[model samples]
Target chain A: MSQKQIAGVTIDVNDEGYMTNHAQWNRDVAAALAKEEGIDLTEGHWKVLDFIDKDFKEKSAVPGMRRMNKVGGIETKELYSLFPNGPIKKATKIAGYPKPVSCV
Target chain B: MPDDDEIKKVSIIVSRGSLEGVYPGLIMANGARMKGIDANLFFTFFGLHAIVKKKMNNIKIGTVGNPALCVPTPMGVGMPTWLGAIPGMSWIATAMMKKEMEKIDIPPVGEFVEMIHDAGGKIYACKATVDMFKLAPQDFCPQVDKVLTVGEFYEMSAGAQIIFT
Candidate 1:
């Protein structure tokens, strides 16, 4: 773990730039991190990030693509369009969750 | 300079009919998309079963001539080849394998292919195989994008890594 300043606050982050402490994550930090990914948090983007955050807090695990489609009410293609490239990994990072574990 | 050696795309070929044989290609294709890489899955020979609307989900595990087939016990002894040849042995093995895959959240073959497609991965059927099997377009799963000859596949997969599973 390493300390990095995000959104004007010192925070602990992993080597991959994911926030290590969930408590330190906020909308500003998420937006700042998303900027590094070349993403401007739009309404669609926020919907996914918020769903991931809620899912992590309630289920205590990162939601995979299927759960994001079936339970989280986001279409697979829409998720891809929202995050582009690596949706699950990118979304999880912005949502303050660890890398996703499930493949499907 | 950007890393020229980085893998920007992958084309995986699935040529086997067994359940285990089909999944590696699917997983790889999906995983490529997950990495923001372009990916394609080409189904040929026996692998066509994986795209056949009727047979995709009913695929069975390879039981015969496979040294890897084993019984779940303390000893972990491998199943004898002769025993593997027995009828219903493959069914039993397939059932157990599907159970384990489910425990880990691996979706069924049909659903898996759809997931890969939904992620923008292309799925193709080999022209030669389709001709040999006398398969019509309607015989394939809905997610299959096209039927292409080897030359056509190579044309599209240019500058991409090709993996035969």
Candidate 2:
């Protein structure tokens, strides 16, 4: 594990830059992370991040992409349109969860 | 070919009918979509069974010539391929694989296709194969976006990584 500062807040992250401690996550940190990823957070982006955060809290894992589209009402195209790089892995990381176990 | 970093899409050609043959393509396509890479699954030849409405659910693991099936032991013994050729053995292997997949929460073939479709992966069947089998467009699962010729597949696959499974 290594430590880095985002938005002037220091937190532990793995070699791949995924946050190691979910507790260090906050809305501000997420915004900073999104900015670093070249994403401008919008209401739709927040909808996905919020859904992922809530679902991860309850299920202890980020829901699969299919479940995200079906239940979150975010279709696959829309998801890609929002994330535009790595939707599941990137979104879950920004949402302050570990990398999804099933995402390739 | 586009440089590795320039790959914006992935076109997976599924050319086999067996569950073992098709699952890798499905998994890869789904993974690509999850990663926000455009994904297209092109089913050709017997791979059409993967998207055919009545046959997708019935994909069997190819037991004959399969060298991977083995009885677990300290010595790592494998079942002989001849035994695999025995009638009904494929079903057993399919059942075992299905059970293992269920334990890991992997969806079945049909449900997996549906999931991929919902995730915005494009599914295509080869037009020549479809015409050869006399399969109408409606004969395929609703997820299939089109029946395309090889040239069209190549056109759609431009600037994409084309993987064969």
Candidate 3:
């Protein structure tokens, strides 16, 4: 199929082996995280999201907890409260930060 | 705006010297790790005390010259930093800071350092500051990754964001 449509999002796969639709996946993941974390989509939440987005834009790697705290000004206790799965891994996943090689 | 492919790296440097200063570095470094970015913290000067085992757990707030002191907040006004050096003043400031830390849930510096390491952030000691202050590895927490020169830190910090908390 030229395009696979899911939940009104389009997924394009090219013959060159590039797979699209990751953005859609990111959005879906982010939304799920918002709900799970009880995030109200306020400026504070956006601050964290924007930070993660910027980091992704720069490093091509998901930010770890240390970098997130440094850039986002979020506390470790707060992060732990927000993400029970451990802030280092869960927050990045929710923020749509690309998976780090060490994570798996 | 450049596409994702054009992105390079994100790095942060934290150097600060108050009870509050240590928090920012620790918090930031942990946050960076959460985002999957390479994070390094260079603890130098008074900031170095936060990593030292004996001093880390018992840091005294500098009430003298502390901007927070003058703030009309619930925490009460503090003395000046210069005054903090007074023989008895350091003890009072230390006591006050210890009390405040207790009131909050903030753990001791040693514990905080462990948390940073557990979360995968890199910690380095400043060699020059160590020599200047007559500190050795034994003087610091065991979690320290290395004692490095400022030049070494800069070499590692290249192309990464360097922040002074």
Output the number of the lDDT-best candidate.
1
Q: Give every prediction's interface RMSD.
A: 1.2, 3.0, 9.0
Compute each candidate's TM-score over C-alphas: 0.93, 0.83, 0.54
Which ranges in model 2 have alpha carbons more than 4 Å from their true place? Answer: A1-4, A38-63, A66-82, A101-104, B1-6, B72-76
DockQ of all predictions against the true structure, Cα-based: 0.71, 0.48, 0.09
The C-alpha stretches of model 3 lying farther than 4 A from their native spots are A1-104, B1-16, B70-105
Residue A22 in model 1: shift from native, Å?
1.3
lDDT of 1 by residue, B41-120 (tens): 99999999999999999999888898877788414798777898898988998888889887666788999899999999
Quality class of the docking in candidate 1, CAPRI style: medium
Off by over 4 Å in 1: B73-75
lDDT of 1 by residue, A1-104 (tens): 89998799888988888888999988999999899999999999999998998889898999888788878999889999989999999999988889887766
The clash number for model 3 is 40
Reference-based TM-score, model 3: 0.54
Q: After superposition, how far is residue B124 of candidate 3 from its true place, in Å?
A: 0.4
Candidate number achieving the greatest TM-score relative to the actual structure = 1
Output the number of the DockQ-best candidate: 1
Error of 3 at B12 (Å): 4.9
